[model samples]
Target: MNVINKLKETAVSVFPVMVIVLLLGLTVVPLDKYLLIRFVFGGILLILGLTIFLVGIDLGIQPMGERCGAELTRKRSLSLLLICAFVIGFIVTAAEPDIQVFGSQVRGLFSFVNKNVFTFVIAAGVGIFITIGLLRTVLNISIKWVLFILYAILFGVMIFCPQSFIGIAFDSGGATTGPMTVPFIMALGLGVSSVRSDDENSFGLTGICSIGPIMAVLLYSLYLKSQGNFDSSSVVQISETAEAVAAGSPLSQIFGPFEEISGEVLRDSVISIMPLFGLFILFQAFLLKMTARQVAKIVIGFIYSFIGLTVFLIGVHGGFSQVGSELGFALGSKALSNGGIWFVLLIAVGLVFGAVIVCAEPAVWVLSEQVESVSGGTITRKLLLVFLAIGTAIAICLALIRSVAGFDLKWILIPGYGLSMLLMIFCPSMFSGIAFDSGGVASGPLTSTFVLSFTLGAACVGANGNDSFGVIALVAMMPLIAIQIMGIMFKLKQKKGGQK
Candidate 1:
């Protein structure tokens, strides 16, 4: 493969995020030697770590995912398929880098709440949901009717959830359904469709998969409820007062399974990889029925992916994540900052993120290409990317605004999803599927970690905003609006047979 091309893709994925950090730094951080050196070195490490990650995903994780998916599909019975789907979704989601990032972030506030259990449960929830999602797509069910009922049940569950956890649960939904899950889940949909009797049933896997975590987390919150008082002031602190605020960099804070102690980082590393490796063995032995040789090669690939990921995680947790939190916190802390600065920053970062998302998201591009080809180029990549870019920009702006105004995320989410669900009733069958799937794909890996962090920092710190937990939900929501709205436009054009 072209190493240069690979690097460019990684850079694109990292660049918009880096730009946001630099912008925030200029506005808030002093241009002294210490700050300058810190930013420069942090920037370099983040880029390098991202490069390693992209290479790993391409080399190992993606292939293993595809293999697992293909193997899982060979089973024909519904119960067998559901069982396979749950296992695959659970394991793969368990390994997802983005979800793990969010869990660690939450540990900043909820001291006793285990990040590991949260990750595993969410992954299992997604797996179970995806199994149900696959069944819906295959059976050709109405997307809206299902979501309407499920969300209603989900909201009812939320009534009993701890208020502190309500946001965490909603946020977990967006965090878990990311780049790693997208391609493999989409592939699973395709594999199942290939063996099924209908073509329309294979699409729209995202609609169902996207909502699974929402319900799961909301339900899980009930368990956390009896722990008493959801919003414990001691566990988390909020401040608008002028103080020299600083949190140590993520890398230096935690070293790995054995970084600081009796090789604790080594233990952590094994803990991190075990679910994945264990699932790999299970798939090879009972699921795939493949010979030792094939499984060995996949294992080799996973190792490279693992190394790249380890470096990447160390880099983000140590470097970029800290930079992101501080930048927003600093900027938000500044009451003297101009609205013009916020507006300009929002538009600029939004556009950059939109462009970067269009090209660097291999999974999104791959899925888009398939749609265009399947429809005999009736759906052009140019059109798909352009609309997706436009949607991404809008989403980013809304997220930034949430930071500035301290808007309740549900205000955006409720209306945005309501509109998306409404459009499902009118848009073309295929476009509806593609549009809903686009929501999950648009947020992807890059946005979940970096963009979401940037928003959280600015809202929580820069603006001294407390209600900033729902940026991911908004990020996930905006794409639904843009894509579905565009789908309506496309439906109009298709009716006129314009340029087709």
Candidate 2:
């Protein structure tokens, strides 16, 4: 029954993309038969892989996070809690599939930035911010004030940071809170807040944690810019074609990219996941000391997580990446050639794509579920999903406009964030946290892998690589406003209900 439910959920999530792709293939962009076959096969794998991966998260990762968080808070040792938060934050983020994929894309663009170093810096940023988030909860600090102060610091720092690095820095924040990190961090937040008497504190830890990577990356970008050891060149290249083999095996042709990407993904997954697993075991021995049954369940959950994530990565890299880039390239080139009608068509496609793609993000489901549960059914999943879809659609429209107009990202971000911060002042306290966190949640693996590739393809039409980098940041940003608007509506409704 559980397996069937998971399959149903995966299918619902994946259906929109499949429909969109088919529509494009039949209409504007006729994909090569071979590529189309690969894409279809990849989509199948994505459904299966995501189903298994989400199940594993429910069984293993979420439980581990909650247990560890509750245990840590029970210890009542501030130093120990901080250390554990930092370690968990760093390890989980370093192991995040979204972060790994985004890092590879960044490295492909700018070979000068060492991939390992870049990934570690982002992970360190997550770790530090998570530690701060934990402290905020323990200290009973207001999330709105913390966010206001942090954004003030962030925007101030942005003045000194290089323009080229700004988009990538904000994108890092969204990418960090993906499938691997969201369930755990959110569970941890819930667990930690369980110790508190107030319900409000339960919700904001993830929101605060999301801010860390942006600040960290911006600071690092400043350091890199200062050193004067970076490349600003923008190259527009498509996916590499695999060599034809005379053996002519059909299976070999289908699985060629899978074989290539699987090995690297497997190696990276092990290296990334093992440390966190090992740390959990140590914590169990020294701190948690659960029974044999509990230990065994978690261990099994870890195995499932590993298998699920591996399959998911294979599907994404082998199936989605090439097709997305190809579609974007075709659409972008067409729009460039036929300006008036084609441009309008591109915007329409982007808006629809943005709305549909958010539905497919695994972390988005987790977030919506959390919000609905935390709000005691006052905020329905359907409502939140609608708002998120609308927000993402607007974001995509803005990204397309920016790509076509060749505007600086600051023109959008400065005002976008400024309005969000102002909204925070007016929104209910809980909504402020949820709104900010939704920004990170809405821009998950799907946006990073597919929508981002799509935007980059568009940017390459007549723009630099840096132009598209901000698209994900925009996708991440708009949700802050949309959700906060929902919050305002909720507050008004509550007041009206009180008068009755």
TM-score of each: 0.78, 0.93
Best by lDDT: 2
Residue range 4-67, candidate 1, lDDT tens digits: 7756656765666556556556654543233434445544555565455455555555555556
| Ten contiguous residues minimizing lDDT sum, candidate 2 | 237-246
Q: Compared with the true structure, what per-residue lDDT tens digits does model 2 show for residues 418-473?
A: 99999988899888878877888888777777787777777668555344577888
**lDDT agreement with native, every candidate:** 0.63, 0.80
